[model samples]
Target: MPVREFSSSVPLWAKRIASAIYVERRRAGLTQAALASRAGVRQATVSQAENDPRSMRLDTLEKILASLDLTLASARRPH
Candidate 1:
């Protein structure tokens, strides 16, 4: 069987993920700096991931989501 590649598009998913992260961070009363510290990533990295998740690696996204107490399963669903 041939290996198949998934679409590289993120579209609204990135926005939604970004929104969720932003909301959670706010709810936790954390600034971007604090969130970055907790996640052990640069503030800019968080900004980019939140701003454009499409350009991020799955592992990095997973880490960020994990830091926010979320999971990829929650970010995706059956059509």
Candidate 2:
């Protein structure tokens, strides 16, 4: 499936992170359980992060991203 862009309205960081992870995971053709195992986290944690990232910890997010060969980055928003 083609990756969908997140709209500007979804401004929350957690939501953005979750959307990114979900997309990358799909692109890599990996299941949630497989990602969880690769990231050394519980399957439920993967599900929760995908469904509600606000509840996820930063370290856990980092680990998940690392497992997918992804990294978190930030840039200043245009004024």
Candidate 3:
């Protein structure tokens, strides 16, 4: 398998996204594994996103959010 290069530090935007995912995951009462299954992604993928979401792809994020009954539009709006 090829190696992936990640930033040493997480950016502000990534931190915001990670925070949102963590909070939403908790609110939905789903474990990382469960959310991964529902979103058709690996558990590690969810973990990485929750920890540092800078490298998270738009499609993957959309899948995760949709699995949690969320939309990019809703997420972008200030709550």
In Å, residue 36's CA in model 2 sits off its true spot by 0.5
Q: Which 10 successive residues of model 3 have the least lDDT summed?
A: 1-10
Instruction: Candidate 2: list runs displaced more than 4 Å.
Output: 2-11, 74-79
| lDDT of model 2 at position 71 | 74
In model 1, which residue pairs have backbone atoms overlapping below 3 Å? none
Give the alpha carbon lDDT tens digit for every residue of 1-76 in model 1.
Answer: 1222334565666666766666667778888888888888889878876566777888887887788887877654
Q: What C-alpha root-mean-square deviation, in Å, does candidate 2 show against the real structure?
A: 4.5
CA lDDT of each prediction against the hidden true structure: 0.70, 0.74, 0.76
TM-score of 3: 0.75
Candidate 3 residue runs with Cα over 4 Å from true position: 1-8, 76-79
Error of 1 at 10 (Å): 6.7
Per-model TM-score versus the true fold: 0.75, 0.74, 0.75
Model 1, stretches more than 4 Å misplaced?
Answer: 1-10, 76-79
lDDT winner = 3
Inter-residue clash pairs, candidate 3: none
Model 2, position 20: C-alpha lDDT score: 72
Better-scoring candidate (lDDT), 1 or 3 = 3
